[model samples]
Target: MVDRNSPIPIYYQLKLHFKQQMKSGLLQPGDRLPTEMKLCRQLGISRAPVRQALTELAREGFIYRRPGQGTFVAPESAARLSQRTTIRILTYYDVLWMASLEQAVHHWNFSHPEQEVDLTVTMCPRSEFHQVLRRAVAKGEAPDMVPLDYVWITNYARAGYIVPLDTLDALWTRILREDLEPVVAHHNTVDGKLYGLPTQADVTGMWYRRDWFAKEGLTPPETWDAWLALLDHFSSPGMRQRWGHRYAGAFPIGTAAGEATLNLLLPFVWVAGGELLDEKGNLALDTPALRRALRFLQQITLERRAALPPQMASYRWWNICRLLGRGITPMTLGGTYEWPRIREESEWTDEADAVAHLGFVPVPRPSLDAPPVSSLGGTSWVILQQSPAREVCLEILKLVVLPENLAAFCGDGLQISAYRSLNRRLATTPEHPWLAKVIPLLSLARSRPLLSDYPQVSRFLQKMLEQVLWVGAPLEETVRQTAQALALLLEY
Candidate 1:
């Protein structure tokens, strides 16, 4: 309480006093302010000053306004510059993400027992995530943090729904000490600022059936020729007449149109020594390397009739797991994201068969003195420019990103931590049996291109690639046209 007789104006005094209370840890985040009536009676100030201070606080996001409900303390986000009194996070997939967050937040609550942070999850139909995203931004109801993929983020970042995290890396890594992956530091950065922090990362890689490979007396393919030979063995006339290379019934598998379609195709291309865009932002798909890459892709689709299961085209990353979970595709290309979902999820089909049939390996490449390559992909938690609780929001984020905390998100949530230190530890965890192989696989991965107009470039490239494989267009023609379209959208 402050004296009205002080030289400062009544409202000014009140504002300063309340500000001190908040900043001094006397009023932590989510601790509601005294009601106007209570403040008026306590301070012996009239309603005018009390209301003015409350209005000012609400405007500044010190408190939130509700139509019928009283004001509340702001909630948390990446940086809640304006507090999130009520944040509804609409996640499209990755079920484990929230649970990990909840656990982290729970621990945070234990440390700050007086404060509260509420997080609500609404499962937006995966297909409508984009539409809903636009609506949320337009309506000023955007979530504080989200599980965004690589492709849509650049546009969203440009659109202001995502806020840049320019100074969090060192602090964030210290907080997560052992949980963040090495490449994660570089993967989620947009223009040198970290945009998202993944609890886990899953890039495209070859997932083969151990039993199938062993039964056929074949090792994981290493070179392009070896891969083709494996395909040839599976597609041989006698084998085709039988149950597709000794399997009772299973089909060849491939990547689908995912959140980042290029993650699937580009690694294969890069391993073959292709570069999609040059430093000058020029779009050139006419490279011999690109041609060779397409030739390999075409071989997979046309020669072996290798296709993603019909259901996968529309499914988010998890559906590919379902296709794998069934014995329908014994050999597929997926990452750790699908690990939990693929563990014998089928009910009508052979559940035991699927569980035992599943296995993973880095996408084998022809090591013709070419630098090994893969697609680096991950997601991160970003602050919204509009948040009011920016400081506390970061505190909560750091808490969630702790090394011990991050493991639950990765091993439990099926994600990859962005901290290199943590990632190395995760790779060594005996519990994650595949981490040894998975870490090496990640060495060659590069994040999908960072273009200003990524959405348009993505759509155009996806259409051209699909046309090349599904509709029989010439690879050169598809590349030329797609490059032209890309140049129009991305040549900045």
Candidate 2:
């Protein structure tokens, strides 16, 4: 809607209209907008104002035009910046986590009103996150700060999208070394340069029905065989009848093209003693251990039929939490970030109630004596190199990550803090008893190889996993082809 005779330029009015639509939720992330010709026809305007408006919009990061595809809404983080001192922070966390971060931002603004720095936190859906980020980066509209998965820190640092924190000052470096957990701190540093700061730390684990296990007089599985046996037992017709569920277990095998598929499945590769890279940085993905891991997945999804539908392979990461909360599956592999969500979704407000019902354990190993492995889960905050207010962003980040502020932020969201001191406090506190059960397992958590081309490698592995589990591709051929593709990527 535009006023034909208003003093405002037509292009400026059009831009404001689109912005209002996005802010009001009339348009959403990944939603395609009207084509330029369509808009021209609808508004009875020439192509000049339409092109001018879209060009400005693209530069400000409001909309992105794919080559063959039409313009789509960009990530909320890259929304056109108003004429104020604002620093945008983007995350893929749930609404609750955003609320917690919003509180910290508000407090910081209140304390420094004279030189107020507006910190806006936006939640971007994980399924579209990669596309959103790519568009934002291409337009030079990356958010001031973003929460990146640990595995992505290396890739982003290598690409020069993020600046090293060591360039800040001595005080920031000291805080990073002394306050953060060693594993988290180490992962944030790339080639001996610190590039990010941790917001929370998590370990991947499988959630089970505690009461159901107790009723059946069964303990959590400790080995691969026992794990499958548990799923088979529960998948039987009688067991399904008793539990009133359609499936025995589930996994996020979705094609969302991000960390979800990789994070949950990495433990299996580690448990079978497979590594993604060799001593010479060559692709080691075609090893027997990895084959074993893939075979087991094939068994569950194809042969035993103990897992969710084949369509589950294309589901989003959060779909598992929703399915689990609804009792669609008795078990699913997930991380600590989902516990609070499970509670809220299942309508279990009392922490004790959620604890009594939902149970999480480290992923099982290949043999009785072999220790289980968990992927190093959660994200870290990195400042984009394109941001103009780097110093102000750092100061604001310091306030947000303060010991007390961090404790409140992560604690409220049911996440383990990255700060060593806060983790130690939660390890002993009754308020965070669930975290206590997870503390010992952190010692066994494994991190993926930090490679500049890891993103492409991850995509290849994901497609390989899908081809076998969904399309019933031959195991050896698929593995070999994926390995070759990864080799080429690594070489580049």
Candidate 3:
């Protein structure tokens, strides 16, 4: 029976009620369940919660619905519920991870028939993923596992929405931690506990046309002056005509690009020796280094006209990659993850063909002597606290991170592995020669600040960029005001 006053959501309670019925043989396989209206009346609840419960039950394979008919227990529901455990997962539109999870489940079931496990994967759109995930948690419909952005670990952990991986299996967690790259491991840890398992690692940098550079007797830029000179060289009418290029470079510059803008541009702060937070973990945005970085961006986009201002402000996050892939732009501020998309958009035959024409580099520093920097970003699998299948999910995760499985996932996705050993192994292989180039960048990569309010902070940063770069607001004032605004936000 559904308990209205219980802490658990009404819909989830109803879901459990139905599961109990199935387990007790009261609702046998192929038995028709009551209609939504009937369930609502019996439970003395609203229709919405009743529908939500039924929908989730159907999605999880506990029931099947026929159009214009009714819902019935799945034919094999009895066997499945009695024998195998089903692990529910929610992820964004990452087909590689989905395929890897599916393969991992299949291997697990095949190898351990007695403890067979099934998977129910739900995919959400990238744009709406954050909101959808929060809604699911609020509704007590959180899945057993989810692929979360690395930066979001702190938020979820602090909210108690996610379980610490170590709490489930400390020894396995420690081994997994030791196997991961130092930075990757660090990003998934909070309060000295492992909170998630990162599946891949990615670094943000610039993508340029290697073939064009070679043809013109030019080299990849390493400093601000050299970068500016290269942009100027490409912006010329003759150079533009010679290369058939529409723009010298492209990047996201406004809120429309969302977090991509932050990932691509934040490295400039590090290049200028700025940090977003002080040692005390307070807002530290109004620094000279940050000002220098912002001014540099303003000069390139608005003053010198190196890129299309209107387009930069409005571009979707992937637009720069599309431009570079289509040969419309010679250079683009992008990430390692964009390689597959670039290859697809350019219609290249394979990784080798794409590599022969494209070159990737860390965003340029202020001086040639300064070290290059990039923003580290990746997705990690987190088990939800609300899940009843944590142990089963953990076992599946173990299989997912097995060396062969992780390597296959990374290679197929053209992603860098979070494991140091896997990366070292993959780097030397002919099948993933590109790893040899990108794996080194992980050393210079830095993660976004891990704050519970990071999403809000990112939005503020995006608005700051738009105000100065697009709206022509005074740079100093905008920086100062933005910092103050962030301070106020954090205060509450």
lDDT of 2 by residue, 17-99 (tens): 88778877788878998998999799876655577567656654567899988999987622323324778877664443333
In lDDT terms, which candidate is top? 3
Q: Native-vs-model 3 lDDT?
A: 0.81
Ranking by lDDT: 3, 2, 1
Candidate 3: where is the Cα deviation over 4 Å? 1-86, 94-96, 112-118
Each candidate structure's TM-score, on Cα atoms with residue i matched to residue i, is: 0.71, 0.80, 0.80
Please identify model 1 stretches exceeding 4 Å from their true place. Answer: 1-85, 150-154, 166-182, 235-256, 306-316, 344-358, 366-368, 413-416
Candidate 1 lands at a TM-score of 0.71
TM-score of 3: 0.80
Model 3: weakest 10-residue lDDT segment is 4-13
Q: How much is the lDDT of residue 324 in candidate 1?
A: 54
For candidate 1, the 10 contiguous residues with the lowest summed lDDT are 246-255
The better candidate by lDDT, 2 or 3, is: 3
> lDDT of each model, Cα atoms only?
0.60, 0.74, 0.81
Q: Across residues 78-120, which tens digit of lDDT does each residue of candidate 1 receive?
A: 2332232444567764444554565556566557655656555
Cα deviation of 120, candidate 1, in Å? 1.8
Model 2 per-residue lDDT at 432 = 69
